[model samples]
Target chain A: MPREDQGPLLEFKAVNTYYGDLHVLKDVNYTIGRGEIVSLLGGNACGKSTTMKTIMGVVRPTRGSVTFDGQPIEKLATSERVKRGIAPVLEARRLFPRMTVYENLEMGAYTQKRGAQFDEDLERVYSLFPRVKERRNQVSGTLSGGEQQMVAIGRALMARPRLICMDEPSMGLSPLYVEQVFDIIQEINRQGTTIFMVEQNAAMALSIAHRAYVLQTGKVVLSGTAAELRENPAIKEAYLGELQVPAAA
Target chain B: MTAVDVYLQQAINGVSLGAMYALLALGFTLVYGILELINFAHFNVFMVGSFVGLGMLELLGVMPNDPALTGLTLVGVLLLTFAVTMVFSGALGVLIERVALRPLRNIRGPASMITTIGVSYVLFNIVLLGFGADAKNFPSPLPQVQFAIGGAVLRLREILIWVISIGLMGGLTYFVQFTKMGKAMRATAQDPDAARMMGVEVDRVIITAFFLGSALAGAGGLMFGLYYNITSYVIGFQAGLRAFTAAVLGGIGNVPGAMLGGIIIGLVEAFGSYWISAAWADVIIFSILVLVLVFKPAGLLGRIAPNKS
Candidate 1:
């Protein structure tokens, strides 16, 4: 494939990831352009989380390269990758339970030097999630599931990331929270941050994502505009839980 | 002297002894909090640190026969010896982690823990071979002043131990609670992978914990020598077990808990020695350890977590 005038912000070229002898991701290739929301859709054990981990440098690619901002960062540590502007809102909202809400946000900016800019970013996050500001002093472990999700997103935003990789943003959230969370995702993207999301909620993910990829058993089985995939019969049948029988059969 | 006054004096002695144990327990807790390794070699580190403090004092011209150095000069000499001993012990801790523990980090099971036992033996033999098996008298430079508060006598050496240990503990608390690196250490302790995601260097955090823990233990060693006026290669085993018991009593990973546990153990030992026989102190302490393990396995401050082990 020929390169565009402005290359993709993040790219995975034939990436293969493994956990010991168990092969998780095989020859996976995808790209997220700057300011675009890319959703990776998959079922259980389809390597969606592995893809996110590989991008964040938590899981290294055993074969192939992962490029971020046009730089090959295959061997970089997770902290180094964060320095290169990648921040992850990990699966299951792994907050430091003992720390207060404000402290959790402070930790998100650990890669950056402390100064005036931190307060500015903090205010930005606070403005985005007023609830997080209200309960800033409370221990994070004591927060409700929906409240914890808000803080988790607020924590990731404190990094001032150019590209945010959110793993299952809607997991364990109420319907009201899921809608609010997706709305916030769009708002975040509109303000100029590229998003690479791994989601099991195909319907909600496709609704906001500009481009999408369907992964199956460690391979990119389908890729197209979100609009096109939303209309595809195969996607609706498999992921959307809709039965599509051959009308002519 | 009434019975009340004697018990009061014993209580004061117990607090001073407890402060020293708290220092050692803090080291065990810091390293164990981050790595989940018992660091059995920390006992030897404390032993080595006492020897190093002795060496530093000798180099500074403080002799066994020399008159007690008073005023600012005594303060300066003590500070200098503490600084050198702490740095030496802290570096030794880092070296042990890098050499013995780091290699076994990725390997599952008790490889690193067993390695620590091996290291404890190596340091024990090194000290034995270098300094001989007999206990050496540790000379103190503080003036022999006795003061009484509410009919309880307190020595200058005991006062110094309390002051230095409390000061160091206060400093450790501030570092962990307020500073950026301290926050990283806490974050790493809570969830290392999440901390890594937030750009905290887990390796550096681990190193920092080891350094801080070992340095505190080093300070404790100096205090132990000053208070007991004795140093021996075999001292590490007994002291290490007591401190380890303190850590478990307070809650293994909890910082404030370790301090409390150390003090309690010290008090128990003191009271046991005074009330019962001196030989019964060890029996009582180990009995407390067994009772705590059986009843409150999570310790006085530790939360019950099914996943911790």
Candidate 2:
């Protein structure tokens, strides 16, 4: 891949991630340029989630490099990576169960010192998520799945992240909530924050994504502009469910 | 004194004793809350605190028969001793976490508990070597002043002990409830990986937990020495067991539970000593612990979670 005069905000150069003998992600390579909504699409167990985890340093890569702003961060701790402007809205929206929604947001700003800048980011998140403000005092565990998702995104935004990596934003939500979530994601991107997302629902993901990658097994099987990938015959048959395929492996 | 008066005195004594147990148990439970390990070395830290107090008192020459020492000067010395002991014990706790417990975190085993037991032995032996194995009388520096309250006679030391315990617990409660670091500790305890993803340094939280808990244990030990006038290296084993029992009684991981548990245990021992026999106090407390375990395993304040697959 030829580098633009300016490097990508995030890049995985031939990264191989494994859990013991189980090769979860193999020779994975992709880059998210600045201010891009880059979505990774795949079926369950196809390593879409693993790609997100590797970037977050929850799961380390066995080979190659993961660089953020051309700085290799594969060796960094998860919190260190997070401090370096990458916040994860993890799968299942893993909010602190007993903490209030406000406390959860506070935890998101743990890397940043408590000051004027912290207050500004917090106010911005509350404005972006008026519903979260409404449920500020409520415990996170008791929230509805959609509300929790809102909190998850709002919490990530509290980190003042340069690039927010989301693992399955549409995990257990109605079509209405999914649509609302994509709208918020687009809004966040428009505000100059880059997004890297993994989604099981390919059609909804591609609709908002500027660029997208299709993951199969441990490999990125397809990568292109969202419009180009959406028009690809294979993507229509496999992801968008627009065409029927012959019975095959 | 009448029988009712004696019982009232016993109850007061029990409450005071319970305060010390509550302090120790709070520290014990704090460690268990974050690391899920019994800090077996906590009592030793307490013992070291007692010695530290004894040494400070010796340096200040504030003994019971010291007529020349001013009350204000004695108070200053006492406060300085506490500061030194708590800080030292807190550092020791952080050291244990860094050198022993933190390294064992990645290993999939119950080795942390065993390592704590090892730490307990190491601390015990270190104290034994530094101070002789024989019991050293902790000279109560403050003048023996007793006052009657509600037909029960109480010493100045007794009242001061209760005040100090309440103050420490209150301060701890405020810190945990209102501070950012405290919130981070709670988040890390609930889910470390999630907390890290949210940019919390999990290691710092664990260190804080250990330091706070051990510092409390140290203060408890110094107070115990003052109250009982007995400071021996082996005292830690008995005190640690009782404190551990209190933590279990209240719910091992719950902070308020530990405090409640400690007080209850102290009250039980006090009443049992007065009503039954001093020898049977241990047996009575253990029986109560057995009953509580059989009935409420999550502990008195512990929340019961539904079964997880």
Candidate 3:
């Protein structure tokens, strides 16, 4: 549990998102405090990605409120949300493939005008991801999986966002690269950027997350501290592919 | 002129003609890139721009008395005409977008095209009613200035057309490649949703694209009046068709492709008229378009870039 001193950076209170009549997200609620890694874990079609989209204002909630930095932004447009410092690294690394790596980063800082802070943020991103610096001139599409992820992260960091939402950062990476991604996520969190990540890799997600939520069928089935969830029988059985407790089963 | 000299002179003529087409073609491509609309009204807007230039020239009045003074006055008037026509036409483009296209934003693709085609008719008729159907003799201020390079003899009008068109194209390229707003335009074209996520005001970018493109077409209209020394309301139909074809040939959404496509079409028309007959020139050009469509849908320089999500 985080200390009472630090306030929640993002809050989703009774957010119900729908795609026409599909009812994609059903009264979901979660909170991420400042300087914490909060992960949403679920299976295929379980609304993990929808949750991220709702945060970015790509999907408006039907009957709930989403407060970001204490402002109700449920009715705002995606571009307006972005200007408010809610940046997203969309599913499968949505870097502008036709653009150069450097150009992609510059685009991430679109809300900020050209000035000293823009340059400073760019330098900070380069220092955080040296591979991105070396491949700055290369087109984003040609980059390998791990390197592309670096560009995605570097691009998000360039915005100087209060919180960065990532979707499936480990979805298509090699085992070695997966470990590197998790380490980088922790490093990003350590540097005072709040993270709200959606993933299917529960073990990896829980390992670094300060607080974690396990969703099933568009609803939160389990939510607790990372340490508590790490030892929970339900998570181990459902996510880690372990034996269920006989009585509970 | 010898046989080679005739061909060389035709080539120079082709280049000047193609420069005007390039500007019109570039505008068409820019609109297509953002809105995915054919923008048939742009052709009529080109016609309006020519008329606007004529009106400015008339308003400025003809140079009187001293020959040297006439030269200076003509230069001043032409410059003023260029500035006024481009601004007037650019504003017209914005108006067309607001009145004819903006409300139809959610309409299916072909519906928008049909609407623009209707707008073209309305604008063409309006101009015809005002200016009358007869072709007006657009006066040339310069007194038959001529120069020769090897076998090819060139006129001052042709040289001026080339210089102005090339300068405009260069400026446009710089604006798109180096400026922030231009990047936003490309981003919006690629994926408007993703661009919105990146905090790009896609509507503004679309409007800017229209303004820039219409301005180029307006300048082309001015050049067309100067080079051909004639303006008719119906001229837009043929010119627009040719320029639209040029845009398709260069890859509808590609900037450089539109330019190259225009030049190629111009050259083909010129050479075809010389070698075959003036009546056969359009046939040859259409045949080339058919060939390009059949072989390479991406056009010469167009690389099919995947739309970002």
Candidate 4:
């Protein structure tokens, strides 16, 4: 939990994004406080990924403003936004597959100058994921799904970002990896980097998130603390049912 | 000359000829790797480089049939000409990308490609009007020196071609392999959207690709001039087709593939001309292109990428 004296670390005020003429995110509002783990929860095609894109400046919102740490960042370029300390762990663990694991981690700090600081960050990431260190010279594409996800998270950490935005971090992972990924996410948040994650896994997302927003068809239908949303029967019916389906079997 | 000597001489000629194609093919592959657009106008950039080199040489007081200067003076003039011509052609490439292709970036498909063909025509006419239709005598300052290796004659131009082209290729390889911008370029090629999320300046990378590719084309133009001692607007079309073929033969988007493809095309053309006739050389090269496309569409070094969209 962060002190209430300061403003939210990231704030999206009525942001609406479009792909061509098709509206993908409709007046979406979100607030993530400093050192907090905020999860954006939604089903497929519900604009969850678009929200992440908006944060990273991959997709610009036609209307509304996004502020980070008291600065308006809606008009900034993606690289400029990254220099302002925002980094993304893209969907499907979009690591540079052809590059070696070490190279991929090097790219994570693309916005920063290479020096002792880079070496320190690399050391830190290695400590967090020993497997990443062991596979440093191997090509990233050959890594298994779980390992790739670990590398992806390690790659984002290389940026030394103040806030890391992750999109569907658990997608395509085995159940065992899923729990491990969630544990890492929690551990990362505890280390003081704010996280804003988008997940289709409602049960898993709400389990570790401090606060969460539920989205459906480009709109935020509900927003509250994770504990409150977990007990909400409506959310359980809409999203948590995914976990329930397998459990019922 | 003995049969072995004849083959050795052709091999020498082929390698030198292939050096120019390798440079031009790199331009094509670099642009295609990033934009997936075949810059048909790139050949004309090479053409412009020839004229620009000629103009620079003239400005430096070197004229046709001048006493071929040797030693440091020749090297100095050559270096200056190469630098100026490359920068000129590189700027032209950036202009083409900025004015012609960048606007149509959002609206995908054949629009930008068709626009490149249009730009090619525009460049062709501009050069045609600027330097007449006749073949311009492009002079070289190098002393016409030749040495024999095992009964096969080799010239200074051939060695210089090999050295310079190999040097440029090696430099490009090092840059792409070790540099930060190079990593970003690779990342952009693999996945543009994902790269953007990483804070890569995607547009700047595209511009850099155009600049580097065009600059290489400029160098190729100068090499063609130095090798053949003549250049014209028609050369871009004739040689551009050959370079384009090299790019496709090597696997269109593969950098090293382009280099290998160019050399093979050069050797094939050399042998085809010697064994058959100069007129049939082009037919043989185009046939290789057709065969490669039909059998191994990915080229030798290219991998078949699954369609992302």
- Highest DockQ: give the candidate number: 1
Per-model TM-score on C-alpha atoms: 0.97, 0.94, 0.93, 0.96
Displacement of residue B212 (Cα, Å) in model 3 is 0.5
Sort the predicted structures by DockQ, highest score first.
1, 4, 2, 3
How far residue A181's Cα lies from its native spot in candidate 1, in Å, is 0.9
All models, DockQ values?
A: 0.74, 0.64, 0.61, 0.67
Model 1 vs truth, CA RMSD: 3.0
Alpha carbon lDDT at B151, candidate 4? 84
lDDT scores in order: 0.90, 0.86, 0.85, 0.90
Task: Give the alpha carbon lDDT tens digit for every residue of A82-181 in model 4.
Answer: 8888989988988887889999998888888899999999999999999999999999989999999999999899888989999999999999999999
Q: Residue B194: error of model 4 in Å?
A: 1.3
- RMSD per candidate (Å) reads 3.0, 3.5, 3.7, 2.3
Candidate 1, residue B94: CA error in Å? 0.5
lDDT of 3 by residue, A85-115 (tens): 8888877887776778988888899888789
Error of 2 at B186 (Å): 0.8
Clashes of each: 0, 0, 0, 0
**lDDT (10s digit) by residue, model 1, range A21-134:** 989999999989999999999999999999988988888999999988888999998988898789898898889888899999999988887789999989988998999999
Please rank every candidate by TM-score, starting with the best: 1, 4, 2, 3
For model 2, residues A54-170, the per-residue Cα lDDT tens digits are 999889999989999888899998888888799999898888888899999999888888899988988898888899999999999899999999999999998889999999999
Measured by C-alpha RMSD in angstroms, how accurate is candidate 3?
3.7
- Between candidates 2 and 4, which one is better according to lDDT? 4
